[model samples]
Target chain A: MTRIAEKFVEEFYNSFTSEVLTAADPAEVVDRYYAAEAVQIADGIEIDRDKLIAHLRPVRKNLVSWRYEVHEAVREQEQLAARFTIHAQLRKGRMLSTEVHLFAEFAPDGRLRRATQLTRDVTPQTPQDVTPQTTEAAPQ
Target chain B: MTSRELRVLGMTCAHCVNFVTEELEHLPGATAVTVDLPTGTVTITSDQDLGLPQLQAAIEEAGYDLAD
Candidate 1:
């Protein structure tokens, strides 16, 4: 990967936690990464700048501790795909964790024009996950 | 009214699970969401009436498909 691309990835991880997720005013962070007409899609919904702030507002308030780790990244032409994991320690001992894949399309000036984010929870299972055996078969 | 089992499509990873879980939580009175990755199924427990159309819309917003 080019140095610029690697730098972008490094900045992305920091800016997310520092500027986007933690800031009281997210508009500043938004401006740094997204273009004037940029759109962020989560799931399939289009979340414009203002809406993005709204969506994350609750999370910011409720989050106690969180960690973001980049698993992989690929840069192809003007598009960059970043795969990462987010672990959130929520209130009341509830933990929310997910793997995220983000695809961003950048303008010639290196400003993000559009981005799509996908996420899923992390769940590991063991033998306990299997259904318990019954002592007797069901009566026909 | 108590629980719902949704067969969702395009859920390949844990991110898919998170997106589906978020959709379920948007529903009124949703208490919990259980995502079985191996089966691509989501089980939602709620006290409010969970509508199919609403579930479809939520999933779609997150770029997913709910099997009708």
Candidate 2:
């Protein structure tokens, strides 16, 4: 439905870390937003909802700040796709910034049933052999 | 929406693009982030003027420089 659009995705991202990570009972946030059968895929790793919750249980201990800013967002029927950036800072001065493309499938009840995220580290270009940028035209 | 483009250096991939994009997204009223890799340009959509110092700081945080 129309509810599965940009606004819904924004609400989810906004609530995720701020609500879930900081909460004494993080499971409450997960249960509110994710379906019981939800699956999450990221960085070649996949986990069910329970596992995901368990993994994030320690998120707040090392966290300074984390924010997700939605970039391009699109939706069709029950599916939502977005390209975004995540800025994360840890307590010991470990900082991470990355680009993420995420797609989610919503359950009939409007909670996310499945989600897949693709992330790439924000690193300077690696050194590589390159072709010349310009073709030197011989005098005709 | 209207956009402002910053000619930049040190970005070469989608991850690089997102670096600048995300930095600008942290600015107040910033709405969207777009990067044109071939041109070495990043465009920001925002309702308020993200002053040069702000943009410069963001770019610096990403380990790059904003061209004048």
Candidate 3:
């Protein structure tokens, strides 16, 4: 990626968490990343930016800190496909983390016209050891 | 009434999973939505009253497809 593209990615990640997710005025920050018709998906719910911000407004009030990391990024034409994680720290040492996919498309004027964000809970699974049972009557 | 399994084109990690999950969560009467990254399966449960076409379009807007 070019230096400008790399810088754009870095700045977006920073603003996304601090200015957008954890901003004192979240609605304004959210409007920055999303277009009027942007779609937001969280906790098995989908809504347009207007309704989404309304829902998130309440949630943001309880959140003390929030951060997200983009582990992988691929650029296709004007679209960027990123795989990232969202981690939030609550007031009482409670931490909530989730994974998501972000698709950001830029308009001709260099503004974000559409963004589709998908999120899922992260649950670590334990590896299980499976062994087939042998019948007692089976011949050796 | 119909359930569509969407295979997001740009989704390859947990972040993708979360993004997709968040989108589906907005669907009306969505009982359950699970995004499995390794398998790339977006499983959704609804009351069968929502519009499938609209849902598919929403996924497509994210630059993803509704896989068969």
Candidate 4:
């Protein structure tokens, strides 16, 4: 991704998370993270800039703190794919962590055209939880 | 071990995928979890019996539901 494309992606992702789930305003999302023409796709719903902000407002209420850590970002021509994880807490005292794959596209002018979000849930666990034990105790 | 495909509702973005994959993999018997972005399907592998309640709770906690 070019610097400009990366910048737009950063802003879009940041604002999408912060403004939608953290109750930050659209201006903040726009000023800090999103390109003016960024588009959003969640589930089957698609939204333009204005509608995206509006969609995020209602959803933001259920979240306490939402944050993401990017694992990899790959760009192919005008398309970008970002893979990352998000850790968040809900108002009901529920905590969740998950990974997501984001597909982003850029316009001819280097502005953001669309972003699609796909997710998988993860949990916090000790290393013991994920590691497989091949060593078995000797027959007593 | 058996594997099944599940669709998670209300998921959008990399974070949603991360949250679901992390939570499900922590379950007692889950061996592996795979998510396909375009298809919105979660494929799980486990060596022991898995319960729907546990999966459902985790999904709901993650602010999403298991699609019928």
lDDT of each: 0.64, 0.66, 0.57, 0.62
TM-score of 3: 0.49
Compose the digit string of candidate 4's lDDT tens values, residues A1-140.
Answer: 45544444444555455544443365454433445777777655565666555434334545556555567777777788887766666544456666777888877655567788866667576211211112221110
Predicted candidate 2 versus true structure: per-residue lDDT over B1-62, tens digit per residue = 55788998645444455456666777788998788766778889988878888888887766
Off by over 4 Å in 1: A2-7, A124-140, B1-68
Q: Compose the digit string of candidate 1's lDDT tens values, residues B1-68.
A: 58889887655445456656775686779998998766668888998887888878877765567776
How many Å off is the CA of B15 in candidate 1? 10
Ranking by DockQ: 4, 1, 3, 2
TM-score of chain A of each: 0.71, 0.78, 0.64, 0.59
> What's the C-alpha lDDT at position B60 in model 2?
72
Whose lDDT is higher: candidate 3's or candidate 4's? 4
> Where in model 2 is the C-alpha error above 4 Å?
A1-7, A123-140, B1-68
- Judge the docking of candidate 2 as incorrect, acceptable, medium or high: incorrect
- Calculate candidate 4's fnat: 0.11
Candidate scoring better on DockQ of 1 and 4: 4
Name the better of 1 and 3 by TM-score: 1
**Of the candidates numbered 1 and 3, which has the greater lDDT value?**
1
DockQ winner, 1 or 2: 1
**Candidate 3 per-residue C-alpha lDDT over B1-42 given as tens digits, one digit per residue, 9 for 90 to 100:** 455565654454444454556667667778778876655678
In candidate 1, what are the lDDT values of residues A25-138, reduced to their tens digit?
A: 777766666677888776565667676555454444444555555677888978988886666554333456567789988877666789898766563332112121122211
DockQ of 1: 0.09
**Model 3: how far residue B27 lies from native, Å:** 30
Off by over 4 Å in 4: A1-21, A24-38, A41-140
